[model samples]
Target chain A: MEKLFYFSDLFGVAVFSITGALMAGRKSMDLFGVLVIAVITALGGGTLRDAILDNHPVAWIRDDTYILVATLAAVGTVLWVRLTRPINETGLLVADAFGLAVFTVIGTEIALQHDTPVSAAVIMGVMTGVAGGVMRDVLCNEIPMIFQKEIYATACIAGSLVFIGLLELGVAAWIATCLSMATVLLARLAAIRWRLSLPRFHLLDRI
Target chain B: MEKLFYFSDLFGVAVFSITGALMAGRKSMDLFGVLVIAVITALGGGTLRDAILDNHPVAWIRDDTYILVATLAAVGTVLWVRLTRPINETGLLVADAFGLAVFTVIGTEIALQHDTPVSAAVIMGVMTGVAGGVMRDVLCNEIPMIFQKEIYATACIAGSLVFIGLLELGVAAWIATCLSMATVLLARLAAIRWRLSLPRFHLLDRI
Candidate 1:
């Protein structure tokens, strides 16, 4: 069970790293910059979650796999972009949403392990799902996706709630995880496909 | 001695929160946004530091004063801005630098407590000093001050090294801290006064 969870986490890291490399490439960041954003985008939110929960040494520092996966993914993305046709935007969205869903479940479970209250646990899950991309976008000098009327964080929140609700109803851990991840992934896909988004709050209109 | 340090830490939090609020005002963010940015600007770096070090319960969570000071600072800045004339930019710089210098020393000491090596400690110190402001500027969708040609992070690094070096020489802790903070503050002020800056790295030209 632990092995399976670890594999899913690495998969999340890999896909997010690729998305990060894409952003870095678009920004004309050097190879080093590309790698830095890759690591941050893949690890930033989980790192934040662990830190906020006071989980020691952070996952990446304690285990080298996360960094290795992120690096390989980043390098691969850079090479692929240079050698092949441009990446399809839809493909990137699917990969990104998959990563987000995986991260949300992982974050919620970690929060629960630390005995955080249910509300805070769900918040941590969303933070875990959204913060890495937010950090990546910020580093690229763009608005964070969570603050941009995107359906991203909301999907994570809904999924986390479902995960916790199921656990309370005696669902098996793996089953709960899969269902919750599906919830987030499907919601995000629908949002992307239908151009659905929450209303953006803007003070500029009044001013 | 510990009480004095706590007071200074809170002072840093207060000043930085004010700077954050001022930035929020300029960006036309709503009141909630103003408070959020203020808290992040004041506490974000130290929170990152403690989390990285695996220091549990984080400083702010251990005590309520930091949040209280930050909130008061943010609310006060907003009121001051709306009720009085605009904040003097020079004054803001002084206050911001004060927070940065103090935070650098505090972060360095904490890293040493965790037994990090000298080089890593200096890096941690710089992260503590500059990260909050960097987060603030990024949230405002602007280039971070440290990443610009500014001497900000350099000043923090220099000061942190000084702090550690003096401590290794058997200097009293308080004196080492005061001298180090003075070093950063003075260096930053000089950079501001003389308009000293480093050359920026631009890949666009080479590419």
Candidate 2:
């Protein structure tokens, strides 16, 4: 079980790192800048979770493997982009969906283990799934995609709620995890396919 | 002594919150957006510091006063801007300097309490002082001032190193705090006055 958890976690880290590297590459960031953003994108969410839960020695600082994977992913993506001349946007989109799904489930599970209220757990799950990408986009000097009505954070919230609800109903952990991940992955893919997004919530000229 | 620390901490929160509110105002953020930015700006740095140091529950989560002060600062700034028409650049600048100085010294002290190595302590101090503003800038979709060769993070670094050095030299806690805060305040104010900044570190399009 622990090994499965680590595998999924590292898998999400690698995909997110690639996305981060590609974003930095597009911005013409230096290698160092690319690596920094990659690490922040891959690790920032879990770090936030651990800090909020008071779990010491944040995941990256404790394991080292996460950082190592992120570094490799960043370097690998950069090289691929350099050689290919253009990014595979579709592939990137698919991988990002998987990353979001995996991260959201893991975050919700951790929060549940800590016995936080459902609302707090849901919030942490969304933060974990989306905050890293937000940090990445922000560091790259862009508004976060989640803030752009992209159905991003909403998907995380949906998956997290479903996961927690199932666990509350005494569902097996493995089954619950699979169902939750599928929910996020499919919902995000559908949103991408249909170009679905929430209406912009502009506060009309109160200024 | 504890009262003094609390006072300084709350003061820093208020000042940073105002600065955040002002920035959000410039971006034409709605009242709700303004408040969010204000809270993040006030609390983001210390949150990052505590997370990195493995301090759980973060300060604001542990204590309600930080959130209260931030809310008041945000509302007050928004009201002030609405009533006054133009934000007072000079007043905001001075208060921001104080925020940076006080937050830096306090962060250093906390890290020392955690028994971090000197380098880590200094890093936590700088992060605590400057990261909130970085987060504010990012959320407002602006390039962070610290990243733009502004003498912001440098000032934090200078003050933090000085504080830790003094503590090592057996300086009284209060004296070290005062001196360190002064260092940051003077350095930042001078930077603003003279328009001093670092040379831009452009990565010559290796992509």
Candidate 3:
């Protein structure tokens, strides 16, 4: 179970790094800018989650492997895109959905281990899933994609709730993790495919 | 000494919150958005610092005072703006500069207490000074003002170095902190007054 979690975390980092690199390329950022944004996009979420939960030595700082993986993935993506055709937008979204699902489950489990309140656990999970992308968008001078009507954060919240619920019902850790990941992945993919979205909170409309 | 630090911390929070609220107003964000940005601006830097330093139970989470101060400041700014003319840009920048100075010194002190290396301590100090403003700009969907050719971060780095130097010279803790804060404040103010800036990193030109 531990090994599986570690591998998935790295996988998520790699995918997020690739997305960040692609975004940087679109902006025509310099190589240094590309690398910085990529690393931040991959590590920002987990860093926030650990800090909120009082987990020490932030993941990338503690285990050099996380940094190495993110940096390499970012560089590789830049090179691949240059050599080949640009990755399709749809493909990028699909990879991002998978990364979000894995990160949400991992964040929730970590929060639970810290014995945080369920509400806080769910919040942490959603933050872990989405914060990095939000950071990336902000750095790129765009409104965060999550704040759109898209079902992104909602999917993370739902999966986190499912994971906690299954655990309370005595489900095995591995089973709960897998089921929750599927829930998020399916919701996100459906949203992408069908343009599903929650109603936006437009305060101006009411005022 | 501790009491002084605590009061300064709250003052910094209040100033940063006001800056955030004003920025949110300029962006035409809703009241809720204003509050969210204000709180993040006031507390985000300290939160990151604590998390990075392995300080458990983060200061704001450990004490309700920080949140209370931030909320009150945000709401107060909204009310004040409604009752009066918009704050002048220069006034806003001056207040932000003071907040930056205070936060930088406090961050350095906390890092020193944690026995961090000088380089890490310097980085932490700068982060604490500028991160809240960076977050505010990001949320407002603007490129961070710090990245402008401004002397903002340079001031923080210089003050952090001064603080450490004074401490090494066996200066009183209070003296070192006060001098450091003054150094940052003066440097920032001078930059604002004179339009001082560092050289821009024009990667495109180099390429």
Candidate 4:
């Protein structure tokens, strides 16, 4: 189970690093900026999770492999973009959604392992899923996607609940994880394809 | 002692909020963005402090006054900027240094109150002092000052050590706190004026 979990984490890290590099590339940032974003995108979620859980030494600090993978992924992304002029934004978004789905479930599982309450686990899962991308956006000098026009965090929340429900029903951990990922991925892609958006509450406008 | 400590916290929050609003104004962000940065800058240190200590109901969540003050500070800054054209960036940076100095001491004091080790307290203090600015930078889409050039976190770390040293010498808390704050402020300003930067390890390139 632990081995499977580690593999899943590696997969998520690679996908997220690619997304980060692609986002930074869109802004025509320097190589250093691209690598910084990639590192943040890959490690930001797990860092938050460990910090909140008081699981000290953070995940990346504990193992250097995550950083290694993210660096490779980032270099690979830059090379791919250089080779193929005009990177595909939509394809990167899709990859990001898939990464988000896997990360959310994995984060929830880790929180659960730490004996956090179900509600806290769910929230942590959503936070872990979206924080990386949010950090990437923030570093890239753009409004976070969470506060913008996509059901990003909402989908993570929904998928987390699905994972919890499956656990309650005695489903195997791997199966539940897969279902949760699929739900978030499908929801995100559908939202993107159909242009779905939550209502913006402009409390500032009224004041 | 408690009264002085509380006063310092209030002063720090107000000054930090002003600094945040000033940065937002420099970037020509809207009122909402300005307010967001102000709140984050004001509450950021305490939030990280409480989180590291694993305290429940985070400091800002428990005390509404902090949030209220930050909000008012942001509003006041917006009005001031609108009525009075461009503000002095140099002046704002000085205020930020003072804010960072005060918050570093306050954060260390809180950690000590929680019975944390002196080393942990020092680290927590530096984290508190720097985390808010880092978050603000992330939100505004700029490289965190700590990660780039500046004596930002270094100043906080030095101050925290001084604070701990003074406390160990049976120095009065108020005197120690004031001295520590002054240390951080002077060090930070000097670094900024001199364009100080730590050696960036090119270990990543080797990887």
**Winner by DockQ between candidate 3 and candidate 1:** 1
lDDT of 2 by residue, B1-207 (tens): 789888888999999998887777666555555666788899889988887787766676556678788989988876665565666679878988998999999898889999999989989999999899988887878778788855988999999999988988999988888999999999999999999999976688864
Tell how far residue B184 is off in model 2, in angstroms: 2.0
Off-target runs (Cα >4 Å) in candidate 3 are A1-47, A56-141, A146-207, B82-85, B199-206
Residues A53-97, candidate 1: write the lDDT tens digits.
887789999999899999999999999888987788898889888
lDDT by residue (A1-207, candidate 2, tens digit) is: 778878988999999998888788889989999999998999999887877778677788888999999999999988887787677789889988999998999999887787766766776788789778878988887766565545777788799999999998999999999999999999999989998875442323433
- Please identify which of the two predictions, 1 or 4, would achieve the higher DockQ against the true structure: 1
Q: Which stretches of model 2 miss by more than 4 angstroms?
A: A1-47, A51-126, A135-141, A148-207, B25-36, B75-85, B138-142, B147-150, B196-207
Candidate 3 lDDT (Cα, whole model)? 0.85
**Cα lDDT for residue B19, candidate 1:** 78
TM-score of the candidate numbered 4? 0.59
In the range B1-207, model 3's lDDT, one tens digit per residue, is 889788888989999998887777676665655766788899889888887788777776566688789989998887777666556778778877888888999899889999999999999999999898888888878888889857999999999999999999999988998999999999999998899998776688677
- Best prediction by DockQ: 1
Residue pairs in candidate 4 whose N, alpha carbon or C atoms collide under 3 angstroms: none
- Tens digits of per-residue lDDT for model 4 on B66-156? 7677879888877775565456768878988888898888888888888998889988998888888878777766788688776788999
Model 4: per-residue Cα lDDT over A1-207, one tens digit each: 678778878888998998888889889999999999998988898787777666678877889999999999999989987787776779877877888888899889887787766666775788688778778987777966565555777788889999999998999988998889899999999989998766432222221
Residue A123 in candidate 2 has what lDDT? 63
TM-score of chain A of each: 0.95, 0.95, 0.95, 0.90
Native contacts retained by candidate 3: 0.22
As a whole number from 0 to 100, the lDDT of residue A132 in candidate 1 is 90
DockQ, structure candidate 2: 0.15
Docking class of 2: incorrect
